[model samples]
Target: MLDRIANIIVELKAVTKEAKSLARKEILYKDELKKIKLENVALRGQNATIIKERDQAIKERDQAFNNLPLKDNPDNRKVKELLFANKIVCQQRDQALQELSIKREELLKSLQEAKIAKKDRDISLSNLDEVISKLEAYQNICQEVKSKISQGKRVDADLLIEYAERLLFEEELGSTSERKLDYLENSYMFTDQASINRSLLDR
Candidate 1:
């Protein structure tokens, strides 16, 4: 009977360990999802700005084309020269606008894919059950600690140690996540062909 009881206790410990591991994974996933959402919002803002620039480019190109005289009157050399110059400028603007359109399409596709991935992740998180209990337990522990601290009782060494570990883990995780996000954003900047074209046009 004692051997059987010992085996049950061991099994329980294993289960508890697995639960803790799952809880940690859940927390990490939540943080990652938050980061992804923030990036998506930023991407949307960029897309809006790109669209505005593209519209402006189109408008300028149209204005130049409209200003060009249909018939270059050779007798009026100055007028012919002005019209020819405007035509070249209009062509250049049109080419830049076409390139911007292609880049915008690619960005839209990427944004759509990201949205799908986020939706799938959200569904997965919603189906998860065990993490809620673990989170609640953590919150309860925090509340208890606060209550004890308020009542003038010194926090036990073990409790303080656990809190310290949590703080260290959070600090490390935050630092690493920010570094990773920064690198990813920087990498994307290099691939932003539309932004480069806009810069060139502005110059």
Candidate 2:
């Protein structure tokens, strides 16, 4: 009867210990559940804030897209006007270039004409020089002939005839040629008019 009482006491202690352990586990489970619930509540609040921000961003993007001009809008007309103005400027530039080209051509033509006129003037000056030389040569011949006649020297008939012919044919003597011909016929030692005439005709 005493051993039975001891075993009963031991069994009571074991039951008490197990009950305390289960109570402690229950309290821990409740604390963990409370923390999870708090975390879930916080996550719900963060999700709501994220959704509100996403909706606001979408609204702003839509409003910005709506402000852009459509394909056939009046803003496109402004672009067309600008293009037309640019075309007009380009046309004016082309016209100015054409005028410049025409002016350049005119200047070149004027320059060529000036060159031609200068060349013609030079040729005329050269011809004038030749005429002056001929005049001087005729004057010298006349002086020589006059000197020979005044001094009563024997004039070379052949030389005088040749010089006269040269003045008449090979060169231009203007009025001097006529005077010298007359002087030779009247004052020279040609014995007769026929001899002087023959010498003149021989040329």
What TM-score does each of the candidates earn?
A: 0.36, 0.45
Residue-by-residue lDDT tens digits, candidate 1, 107-201: 56756765665676565555333334334333444555567558665444343344334533443423243543342233234335666445335
Please report the TM-score between candidate 1 and the true structure: 0.36
In terms of lDDT, the poorest run of 10 residues in model 1 is: 182-191
Clashing pairs in 1: none
lDDT of each: 0.53, 0.58
Best by TM-score: 2
Candidate 2: misplaced stretches above 4 Å?
1-76, 152-165, 171-203
Global local distance difference test of model 2: 0.58
Candidate 2's TM-score reads 0.45
